[model samples]
Target: MTAPDLEQRADHIVEQIDRFVADGKRVVLSSSFQTQSLPLLHLVSRSRGVTVYFLDTGYHFPETLEFRDQVTEQLGLDVVSLHSATTKAAQVGPHGHLLFAEDPDYCCYLNKTAPMETVAAASDIWISGVRRDQSETRRQLDEFVVRSDGTTRYHPMLDWTEPMIADYQERHDLPRHPLDDRGYVSIGCAPCTRNIPGSDRGGRWFGMEKTECGLHVDLVR
Candidate 1:
């Protein structure tokens, strides 16, 4: 889509978010604080008391945590950091060490998906910064979708391309994720993430066939 087309789509999503809030629906925006996240965060923060959920997998890069703090403070966001039930020590004690290396899927299930499931139960709607151009798996996603549990997900930037995102961020003067300059296009946990140029998700789960970290997969399934 053209830049203007993407802008219009973003406006529509903000309108939908406003409508949902006005109608008294509980809504939460899930963000990874990646390169594309700030625009969505800025859009939702326009409405008061909208919770922005960030998954704290404990394995995240220090730069990601710092970026999260910066954006939350800069936007005055109503942010909630979700974490796994098991502590890093507890997880490693029983499961051996580096669960992500041994079983990335299950590691993600325990760290990311489980916490989000709790958030999903408490909220009527979930908003995310997922874009179609990011990956082949994401290309099938719709602008609006209803999950099996009845929570509606809104992908405001589903049609947005990298240029569109860059345009929006530059227009708003949004801060880029620190890792972005270091070639980390898609930042996840530190162990599984790498620096891969020219591919949005090539940096994620580098050599594995794993595309998603179970959160999106479990939600859509």
Candidate 2:
């Protein structure tokens, strides 16, 4: 009943099911299980069409892994986990620590974007719970568009404000991220993330100029 008649707050995703889902749609809800995405996942579970995809970057917070299972169990969502075709020694050093300190872009390419590319080739439309309020890059994203890999990106939550997402999640009794109260609205890799007072991770990648994870790194390409 969230979008029975379909309204502006709906972001037009359910209305465009044709593009998001085919005979065997292969539609994936690319989620970090971030709070902004909770509403989208809730919508997908009730729809009975799309499958949720979670990229196991190997560096996610421990709580994130736990919440991932909890949501899957609670939502009754059939989740597909994607992982990089690399090993720990390949991503990190021989010491088994991440190499993000030396090369953040390559790190992301291997961890987040690389695995997603493999699994998402199952369909043209990859629905993400991306919101413009989350980052500067997202602010310019369209509701629907093609990516550099010839895959169409669907951002159902593009126009949603943070408060709107929060309100809807609460109304629906959706599960908030276990760490949301800790000021990690835009949670990411464990090492790269930290808490900021009254912040939704505007401080993420703070010391660096990087805000995105190379998911759309082709803006310059």
Candidate 2 on 1-221: residue-level lDDT in tens?
Answer: 24443344553555565444555555677888876778888777766677788888888888999999999999999887788888767777545567787677788888888888786675766888777786677777787777666777777778777777777777778888888877675788877776775666665676787878877545322
What TM-score, computed on C-alpha atoms, does each candidate reach? 0.93, 0.87
User: Tens digit of lDDT per residue, candidate 1, span 1-221?
Assistant: 56687677778877888899999999998899986888889888777758999999998899999999999999899999999997776565345776787778878988999999899878898888788888877888887889878998877878777887888888889999988887777888999988887788887999999989876664342
Residue 54 displacement (Å), model 1: 0.5
Q: Which stretches of candidate 2 lie over 4 Å from their true place?
A: 1-8, 18-24, 93-97, 219-221
TM-score of 1: 0.93
Clashes of 2: 0
Q: CA shift at 73, candidate 1, in angstroms?
A: 1.1
Clashes of each: 0, 0
Reference-based lDDT, residue 58, model 2: 84
- Candidate 2's TM-score: 0.87
Cα lDDT computed for each candidate against the true fold: 0.84, 0.75
